[model samples]
Target: MEPVTTGLIYAAAMAAIATARPKWEPNRGNERQYVLRPADISPLSDFGIADAAVYPVSAAQFPSGVDRIVSELNGYGKFGGDWNGEGALAPTAESVKEAIDFIRAFPAGLALPSPTISVGGEIGFYWSSAAGYVDLQIESLGHASLYIRNRKTGQDRFDDDIDWRTVGRQWYQEKLSILQDPLQIAA
Candidate 1:
């Protein structure tokens, strides 16, 4: 076969493989359709809030009650108070609120311990929200890590590290529209 024909065949095959599988489409219309079990809510109240405002909780508090709550509610393991590294809980409403509170309380900034998987460096907490489940994107020395937590399971199955210089510049430009003062950048 000619080289051009072979290339055409390969491209066709790649497209077929890419579209053949059913995509995992999340239901963004109504969330109630996915019911939360009673067991899920029980732990939320039990989670101790003692030092939740503090990021990178001491080793003594590893797998804190808050972590347990996050795990039980989301059906996954959470790194509770740790933020620098792998986090114990997925970014849920509760978890995001906790993170926000921590950030607000420590405006000066804080060090988040490395989580489960090392990204070869550290990351600074920036913003978090629930996209599908919990979405946390942190900025580090010169890179950014995007973490998406599972909604029902509270698991971080999707974590990607990107070069800040390449992606962040574009992202910042787009995000600036949402801010009142685009010139004001957060650390």
Candidate 2:
């Protein structure tokens, strides 16, 4: 399957949300969570807000692509065995939640990474271009693996068992610097 662009994902989400109505409910910590349900579907009892990808209204103004990523991950979390008709394993709820948290905390001004799910059910995000490539795989809530390749300098770095919660932003800034300008790093 061809990789889906963030723009396409955003467009599709907006189209779907266009016909939906918002219904608000109080969640943990008294956050005002709202679900965008289709006009035809009545509001159902809330079982798991996470399962529904419901978020507080304040986060609705999140940067572009965040909502699309959340929607995509939620759909992936609902899949069962052989979700792809090719024996691909479905991602666990824990992994999905981890991925969502990581994405929500991503630094601003950088292009949103492309979210991917491994056949073995791991959730990951990657950025690739002629300049370089970077991949971050979520193993659990705070654990992950990172792989970076600099085509210009022929340097490859892989770090496993990383705690993203502690240093994800600063660490990615250093690694992704290669993507911003491979020549500068090569020099």
Candidate 3:
């Protein structure tokens, strides 16, 4: 092959590789996001799918709180096309695991509330419960946030750190279970 023709072929191959490669950009909190084709994450190991202790949450059915959240997670970077122009990263396995753990621990006796779920930034999820009007933040790599309104005052408080066993249990047992129950009001 002529030297010039060989050089041209090499350039073409390099260009093809570059175009096919996923674009990596910095996402929330110093993490990197690959803005590329979405991966199929259907058979997640966690979310109680393999565990007998908790009921499995699947992404097969559309619009279910759990399903929607899972779907968003699986399509994190691909869904919104470099969302917010920051190139949002996909949810980490840890974050997804944390979310599932929280849901699996839902008190069996109480009616599970349906949540409006969405991916926040890259490493976490936002869940809004219509029943008690509660907002839940599930963080994979950092602290999670939760806000519950004081029934009487109707004011909102934000807590970045939540103790699932103590404060969480208190909210579940003391306030959310009973309608119009006063929030403990984390100070």
Q: Which one is best on lDDT? A: 2
Q: Compared with the true structure, what per-residue lDDT tens digits does model 3 show for residues 17-136?
A: 423112232113323323322342244466634322333332242243434444444554344434555665444556656665665455444434443335354334332343344556
- Stretches of candidate 3 exceeding 4 Å from the true structure: 1-89, 115-119, 122-132, 140-143, 150-152, 165-170, 177-187
User: Can you write out model 2's per-residue Cα lDDT over 8-110, one digit (the tens) per residue?
Assistant: 8777877844421122222233335566544534445585323234434644543246677878988889989898889999998899999999987776555
lDDT (Cα, tens digit) per residue for candidate 1, span 100-143: 33333321112222222223222234323232322334444334
| TM-score winner | 2
Candidate 1: C-alpha lDDT = 0.37
By lDDT rank, best first, the candidates go 2, 3, 1
Residue 86 local lDDT, model 2: 94
Model 1 spans > 4 angstroms off: 1-123, 126-141, 152-155, 168-187
Candidate scoring better on TM-score of 1 and 2: 2
- If ranked by TM-score, best first, what sequence of candidates would result? 2, 3, 1
TM-score of each prediction: 0.21, 0.62, 0.41
Clashes of 1: 12
Question: lDDT for every model?
Answer: 0.37, 0.76, 0.48
